[model samples]
Target: MLYLFQQILNGLHMSALYALLAFGYALTNGVVRRTNLAYGALFAFSGQTMILVAVFGWHVLWLTLPATVALGILAAFAYAALVGAILARSVFARLAIRTPNAIVVATHGVALMLMEIGRIASETRDFWLPPLLAWPVVFASQGDFRATLTVMQLINVGAILLVLISATIALERSRFGQRWRAVCDDPKAAAMCGVDVPAVFRHAVLAGGLAAALAGILTALHFGNVSFGTGLVFGLKILFVTAVGGYDSPPRAAAGAAIFGMAETLWSGYFPIEWRDAAVFLGLVALLVLRPGHEETRVAQP
Candidate 1:
């Protein structure tokens, strides 16, 4: 019973990370009608940037937790925005002259380039953040039954979920969301109706950037280690989440993420931990076999 409860707590924490990042990818895919593979790169970049900031803070500035964390968040956000702008201008905007497949391949190339850049920046060294909390905090207890999680983990999970939910509500109920929906339905028609099609695309990327930034920072803070390779693993996992959930619905995508996260946590807990990635891969294959189709057709029309 205790073990079962522990697994549930673990699953929720992992699910929060997956759901937030998947939400960002779903937003971009819904708008452009194409999977932005470079998003994975953006995720890695933000986390790596945070680690770099931490290293500098520790070695040079002698800053404490509050200062270092703030600096990391700021740097991650800035870097994500810059990367999003570049992707919008260089890859997405230019798709007018090429086939959609071209952009798909281009996005993969962009992801590789970003990973290479991260490798170079870090000089092939593993980067880490100072531990956010020294010990786990128990949330529930009853003589011999207890549930515990790190304070940092709890904070990161709660804060990211809150932000994602708030953003979703605002997007669904506000004027900006109305315009975004207009653009997504038919960019040409939206433009004809006085909607700024290109601007909406840019905003979508920027919003995705912010989501990626928050996910990156929170994940790194929770784990205390932000390896350059994490982005690839996370990227693949989220791709599966987006594919399974359907890009048109952020809420559904988040739901898919939770399922994946729980499955993974349970598998790792009961079996060989090293085989968890393979399990995820197998799960993705099975999901695709059961429901295979083009992602663009699934976007919700408003």
Candidate 2:
């Protein structure tokens, strides 16, 4: 029972990390039809950037979290603008003539370029990230029933929950959220109704990027390690969460993340950690088979 409880707590922490990544990816997919594979690069960039900042001095470590998030938002905005502009000038301008496959290939090429850039940026740096907090919270009636959580883990979980709740409420009740919904429903029609489709896309990308950045930083903080390849693992996990939960709803994605997190943690604790990914993959397959077309409709906007 104690072991089970510990596993649950660990799962909660993992779920929070997955939720952050899934939310960002879902938002981008919901708003724009394009999948920004370059997003994984942004996650790597945030971790590497935080580590670099910390190396300068321990005093600067305090700023790593916020600075990483800011950089993520800025990078996302810049990347979105550049990608959107390029597509507008090149591929999108030829939409009438270009095949869907061609556009996908082009975007994939862009993703590869960004990935290579991230790899180059952190090639020489150490992959370890210093711990953001020293103490862990302990709760136990007896030594055998003990459960421990680090300060950073608690902060990460809190941050993710806060973002998820705030985003859902804002999307359903806020004015900007209404415009976001309008653009998501139909960009051309929204434009006809005077919605700024381009601006909305930029905002979505920026928000998503910031969320991804925060997730990456928090993960590194919790685990005390990060590397260029870290983004690949995280991005794939996020994709799984999004697919399993139905990419159209933020809450659903978060729920899916929580489920996956619990499954992975428990499986890792009882079995081999190597089996964790396989367990998640199997769960995803089972969910898909069981919930056919569950995500057919987008969540209604407030």
Candidate 3:
């Protein structure tokens, strides 16, 4: 019983992480109204940039917490922005209106290109952040055992929640939110109503790219590292998770992602760890086949 509660507590962090990344997916899909395959690669690019920054010892040269974090942010977001901008101008701009399949294929190519670039740039080296806040904070103790989480984990959870809240509020009150909702609902209608549909999509793609970068840096900070190869796999996980909750609604996507994170954690805790991913993914696949929010999640016609 104690262990189960501990597991739940542990799952909270992972659940928040899922919400963060899925938020990025929701942002992109909300505006483009189509699946953009480049997102996972953008995440990997951010992670790889962080690895390179650490490799270069820039963090040590900065000599301050804010400066160090700023360096990391610069590296992560710069690469993400550059690649995202390229995708927006070169690929999505030219292909999205005419050949959606081409957009998919082209984005896949871009993803592969980013992965290869990351692999080559890092020289296939592995780097992780030094254990910054490794102290465990005990929340509950059962006799001789204490359920604990690191201070960094708590901080990460808090930071992620703050970001989620701020973004949610901005979405409700900001012009981008209104335009995003309009475009997602009906692109032609939005264009007819004087919304620059293309611009909205580009902005959404950029915003989503940055969101993925933020998630990458945060996850790297928490876990100390990221796999360059996780781009597509992570993106797909976000996709399945959001699909369950309705990708058309960012709130729903976040909720669904949080649920998946909890379920995944619990499954690993109580069942065969090796089968955890298989079981979760298969379950999601079954749910996806059902696709509960089909009408809400349908892609808007270009």
- TM-score for all predictions? 0.92, 0.81, 0.92
lDDT of each candidate versus the true structure: 0.80, 0.67, 0.80
lDDT of 3 by residue, 213-297 (tens): 8888877777777767878788778878877777677877888899999999999899999998889999999998876446444
Once fitted onto the true fold, the runs of candidate 3 whose alpha carbons sit more than 4 angstroms away are 58-69, 296-302
| lDDT-superior candidate, 2 or 3 | 3
lDDT of 2 by residue, 113-152 (tens): 6566656765755656545674878855466567888787
Candidate 1, residue 165: CA error in Å? 1.1
Better of 1 and 2 by lDDT: 1
Lowest lDDT 10-mer window, candidate 1? Answer: 293-302
Candidate 1 lDDT by residue in tens digits, 77-117: 88888888877777777773356556678888988888888
Error of 2 at 262 (Å): 1.8
Model 2 regions lying over 4 Å from their true place: 57-107, 294-302
